[model samples]
Target: MDSTIRTAIAAADGDDPYRALRQLHHARIELTRELDRAEALAVRRARTAGASWQVIAMALEVSKQAVHKKYGRG
Candidate 1:
C-alpha cells in the first residue's frame, strides 16, 4: 500500500540489522497512524451513506458498541 509500509515489508531488512529494525519500528508507527485516519474516513463515509453501526461493526469485525464508542453517533 504505502511506500513506507511497502518498504518496511520488502526492503527494511538486514544490511545493518539494527538500523533496519529501527527503520521498521518507525514505519510501523506511520502505518498505524495512516490506517487509523483511513478507518475514520471510511466510517464517516459509511455513516453518510446510511450505514448502521451494526453493519459497520460487522464489516470491521468489532462489536456494535465498540464501533459506536469509537466513532460515535453522527
Candidate 2:
C-alpha cells in the first residue's frame, strides 16, 4: 500500500480498536472508489485511442462483453 494511505490509517482512531477498524474499512472503501474511477478513465482512454473492447477486456482480464457492459455506452 502507499505510505500516505498507511499513515492515514495509522493516525485514525488510535484510542479504540473498533474505531480503528471502522476507519480502516472506510479508507479501504474510499481507495476502492478511487481505483474504480481510474479504471474507468483508463477504459475511456483506451477506447479513445482506438483500442477494441476485446483488447481492453483482455488486458483487464475480463471478457469483452463484460467490458462493454460496464463501459461501452456514454
Candidate 3:
C-alpha cells in the first residue's frame, strides 16, 4: 500500500468517519486486486526461472497439469 493512500484515508476520517470507512474499503479492494496481479506475475516468472510445474502446483495445491494448462507456454 502507498503512504499517500494512507494519508488520504486518515484525512477522510477527519471529515466523515463513515465515508472514510467506505473509502478504506474501496482502497482495500483495489489493493487486493493489485496484489493478485503481482502474485500471478511472480508465479509466471518463477516458472520461467526453471521451477518445475510439479513444484509450483504443490505450492499452489493444484495438479502439475493444471498449472501447465494455464501457464505452460507463456
Candidate 4:
C-alpha cells in the first residue's frame, strides 16, 4: 500500500515535484479554456439555429438571464 501511495505522489518527471505540479495545473487551465471555447462555439451555433436564450439556458441548467448575460452580447 505504501508503494501505491509513493507512486501516486511521485513526480511525473524526474524528482521535480514543482515542475510536475505546475505542468498538471497548466494542463487543467488549458483544458478549462478549451472547454469554454467549445461551449461558446456551441452556444453560437445553437443561437444561429434559432434556439432561444431560455432554451439554451435550460439546456445549460442556468437562468435565461445568466445565459444571455454570458453570451447574448457575443
Candidate 5:
C-alpha cells in the first residue's frame, strides 16, 4: 500500500494503540472527504471539457449510469 498509509498503520500499532487507532481513523476520514471533493471537481471539469459520462465511467472502472448518478447535475 502507500508509504504514508503504512507509516500511519505502524504508528497506530505502537504504544497507546487505541489513541493511535483513533488518530488513524480520523486521518482516513479526512482523506476520504478530500478525495471525494477532488473527484467531484475533476468530474465537473471533465464535463466542462466535453467528456462524456461513458468515457469518465470507463476511466473510473464504473458504469456510465453510476458515474452519471453520482456526478450528474440533474
Candidate 6:
C-alpha cells in the first residue's frame, strides 16, 4: 500500500501484468513475514520488561489466551 511499492508495481505492470501482480503478491508475503518477526521480537522485549500477556494482547487487539498460547512456551 506504500507509494513506493505502488510505483514499483505500476512499473512492473507496464511490462508483464500477471507476472508483476504475482511478484507483488510475493513481496507482500515476504513483508508480512518480516513484520511477524519484528512483532515477535517486540513481544519478547515487552515480556522481559514485565508486561503481561493481557497487556500485549490488548495492544495487538487479540485475546490474552491467544497471545499466551503463541508466546508463552517459547
lDDT by candidate, in order shown: 0.87, 0.86, 0.79, 0.80, 0.85, 0.85
- Residues 1-74 of candidate 6 have per-residue lDDT tens digits of 36646755776858778777776887687678878999999999999999999999999999999999988986
User: What's the TM for model 5?
Assistant: 0.82
2-74 in candidate 3: lDDT tens per residue?
A: 8646865796858788877777787888888898788679788887898888888888889999878876775
Q: Rank candidates, lDDT, best first.
A: 1, 2, 6, 5, 4, 3
Which 10 consecutive positions of candidate 2 have the poorest summed lDDT?
A: 1-10
TM per candidate: 0.81, 0.80, 0.59, 0.73, 0.82, 0.80
* Best of the candidates, lDDT: 1
Worst 10 residues of 1 by lDDT: 5-14
Candidate 3: give the clashing pairs.
none
Rate residue 9 of model 1 by lDDT.
62
Q: What is the C-alpha RMSD of each candidate to the true structure, in Å?
A: 2.2, 3.0, 3.6, 7.2, 3.2, 3.0
Model 5 over residues 24-72: C-alpha lDDT tens digits?
8877877788889988999989999999999999988999999999999
- 3-53 in candidate 4: lDDT tens per residue? 433444454655888876766666666667878999999999999999999
For model 4, the run of ten residues with the poorest summed lDDT: 1-10
Off by more than 4 A, model 1: 9-12
Report the error of model 5 at residue 31, Å: 0.4
Candidate 5, superposed: residue stretches over 4 Å from native: 1-10
Assess the local accuracy of residue 15 in candidate 3 as a C-alpha lDDT between 0 and 100: 72
lDDT tens digits, residue span 1-74, model 2: 47646855885748777877776777788789889999999999999999999999999999999999999885
What lDDT is obtained when candidate 6 is compared to the true structure? 0.85
Q: In candidate 6, which residue ranges exceed 4 Å CA deviation?
A: 1-8
lDDT, candidate 6, residue 72?
91
